[model samples]
Target: MDTHTPASHEVKLSLQTDLTPAQAEILDNGAQQFLEKLVQRFASRVPQLLAARETRQAAIDAGTLPDFLPETAEIRNSEWKIQNIPTDLQDRRVEITGPVDRKMVINALNADVKVFMADFEDSFAPAWNEVLDGQRNLRDAVNGTIDYTNPENGKHYQLNDDPAVLICRVRGLHLPEKHLLWQGEAIPGCLFDFALYFYHNYQQLLAKGSGPYFYLPKLQAHQEAAWWSEVFSFTEDEFGLPRGTIKATVLIETLPAVFEMDEILYSLKEHIVGLNCGRWDYIFSYIKTLRNHPDRILPDRQVVTMEKPFLNAYSRLLVKTCHRRGAFAMGGMAAFIPSKDPERNEWVLNKIQTDKLLEANNGHDGTWVAHPGLASTAMAVFDGVLGERSNQLDISRSEDAPITAAELLAPCDGERTEDGMRHNIRVAVQYIEAWISGNGCVPIYGLMEDAATAEISRASIWQWIKHGKTLSNGQMVTKALFEQMLKEEMDVVKQEVGEARFAAGRYDEAAVLMSRLTTSDELVNFLTVPGYEYLS
Candidate 1:
């Protein structure tokens, strides 16, 4: 990919390759200049903060377990609250999330949920065309003009009269948009997504009585939240909008971030509306952050549900902190999709009901569902709790004693078996294959699986191998054992996917990547970082 500069701009914005006419319209001269400004002003801080992450991780590796910050104790103890929530964002009972494809945008907007998070992060593959096309599709949706017709079946899709409130989830700080470069460096993917979306559709959103809303993913610390706050303030100033026009919900998905929730909220209090339980990634973060600790190894991913002590502590603490700060405490995703068989579908609905009930009872103002079918189930749970109230923010958990770090880091109880190990290998390989093939969200074995869940699959295996943990069958987890299981799982995947589909997919490449990740001396920070090279 050679870089070519546009003639109309003085800024050094360059493209990896020439854009099509439609793509050019999305990244026109004004948008390019806005991106260049963002890159020049804020891009340097991304690497610095990422290095801070490593430094903190090194401390943890050297025997310093995370605790609430002493320096920021005043922030936690003092009384404060974020800016008020937007009118449209007040009652987010059930939010449906999906990739930003045209059909998904329309259907999600038309779903029974109160909000639809058009995701360019976990649920998207970030292929160049997908990245640009997502912005175009979202722009059309904001204008209430987006529509789609299935090319295969000719079934039509369009937004409903009262569609769900739209929110965009951009790529995390760690990801880079390799398709575009500022000076010689690739642009930060989050900045590109945010700047383009805000530039293109902020006016329409405001005109329609909404603003530029977003979901900030994978935040690790208050300092990172401070950086995003600066970006939000800068964008608002650039557009001559009000200070808090752009509201965000930060995903407290990392172990370190859990220890610093108060500080995180304080840092972005002007722009943040709430913090979400990105449970899948939180589990992945637990294994990754505590990888060097022998006693902290986790069991099968399926067994580590939210009811586990550590996760329960995390959820309870999130609700307490958010409500205390006058922000909504959104729940985690209910990733089940309805099955075709009646019995199985009934089981799926029951599971979703149980999960959503837990969140609603725990004081979460809202929850997430991956499929439209699960929306009604989640809504019923929240509806029962909320009654006519917009949210459960008024239901505080201050009566309970504070959640301690020990409880938050307690060892999860579960048994690891050969079946679980095989399942991990199979799901990781298949998800990676699908991700490389331009699908980041896929249903495997009934549940909707995304990058965060797949991260847990591989990270748990790596941690197990690192600690030489034993499975329930009395077999020690080793590099050799994982390799053997991977081989068996690949064969199983082949048979399940069939010869034609298996031959056509990138299973071999995915297997190689998975093997490298699980066996490497150092845990990779993110699978997508390396896998991004294979997106094209």
Candidate 2:
């Protein structure tokens, strides 16, 4: 294999922080070659694909309902299924996810779960140092030497000898690794993450009984999955690996993706292993995808439980589709962090248990948790049903299963209480402050909140305001009402975090950002896009 390093002139490194010589060397390894190949093939295609989203939205705005694609109806009706579920991926009863920070990487991998999805997406704040250091940490983890001693607490942490199988969740297609510029354009964050990890650690992971595995996030359509398939193939061929060496679990987060499940799986059959329910993002997508329709406004985020009709239908469809297609139907994140208070912990655990039980009873092979503490609770639930079985893929859910796009689009009816509005305002401000200050996953009000939660919080506020929603108190929701609530929430946040930390916490910036996002007439696809620009 011949690979040449291109000069710095060929691609500009725009990282704001100074990278040490060693760090630079590691980042530059095979970067130029892989990036050049990625750009040559896929750069122009991204814009066109993104435009497809606009086209779909226009149809929705024009009152054409989204449904299973007739163009790919044969793919749905066909008897084909994804092939070759590797041993590591077969029994994913409980998967834990977190940012790629050193402590999280160590703890999550050491948590005794089946899979640890080290995320560069929703749970991570993509600062240049964070992204590079996350890469470095995972590399060390693959080599079985990821360890850290907290300087403040003097506690040492290391991975267990037998760690969870690692699956890297790259940034969604909409995000760019702005620190790295290829041909004067920000490199796609997905490629930067996928290439660096694959180039550096694929062989290492393969030698260690695991191969290059990924959890693809926020993919909107089958074409995006097809694009990922080609990238996987090209990377494998470039490195002299076999065609099917890479395996990906597509997160059917977006509403459009839910409609095109079979086609998405078929688009990458050789490389696809499972389909995950990215539950929070799906709600966020629903809000954004239907932002134009006044009547489709969702209820308060807290009221929209997993068992709600639309989400229930969505999860059922996902499980049925994945099982029928010979893929694991991985469930969504259990965002509750075990509370310190005994009573609160018990309450949270009960909720977690109930949620996990539903997924297991519905034939989902696994589910995700944000904290290691709840891993056992999730494992116990899945263990009860799965016992020794690897998965429930043999259970076929035919195409006529009970879910339709009309049902999916149906309005969720619930009273919008003042407490719910206050909760949204508080969470959006607090989460954004944490995100802009370099933490993306935060435990607030006993639940682990990520960017997805923040997205829903803000988007729901926007939708409510847009539709002139009335709170349970009968006060109309408007920009003025939202701002009033936001200011009160900022005061609450300031008091909660205290004077010194609140001042240093960038809460003011967060307040401004949160308010701006909700007040904007246009819907933003991702909060991380603007939030990334604020990070150091």
* Candidate models: Cα lDDT each: 0.93, 0.87
RMSD of 2: 2.1
Candidate 2: residue 483 lDDT (0-100): 95
> Which regions in candidate 2 have their CA more than 4 angstroms from the true location?
1-18, 398-402
Best model number under TM-score? 1
Q: For candidate 2, what is the lDDT?
A: 0.87
TM-score computed on alpha carbons, candidate 1: 0.98
lDDT string for model 1 (1-536, tens) is 12223246575878888889999999888888888888999999999999999999999998888888899999999998998899999999899999999998998999899999999999899999999999999999999888999999999998889999999999999999998887788889999999999888888888889989999999999999999999999988776777999999999999999999999999999999999999999999999998888888899999999999999999999999999999989999988899999999999999999999999999999999999999988988888989989998898899999899999999988999999989999999999999999999999999899999999999999988888889999999999999999998899999999999999999999999999999999999999999999986
Candidate 2 residue lDDT tens string, 1-536:
24333344444444445678857865774565676677677766877888898899889878776788889989988898787898888889999999999998999998969999999999989888788888899999999988999999999999887899999999998888776766667878888888788777887888878999998998889999999999999877777778889999999999889999999999999999999999999999999888878888888888888888889888888888888888889999999898889998999999999999998887788999998899999889888888778777765566455788877877888878889999998998999999999998898888889999999999998988888989889999999999998888788878888999997788889999998899998877788999989976
Error of 2 at 217 (Å): 0.8
Highest lDDT scorer: 1
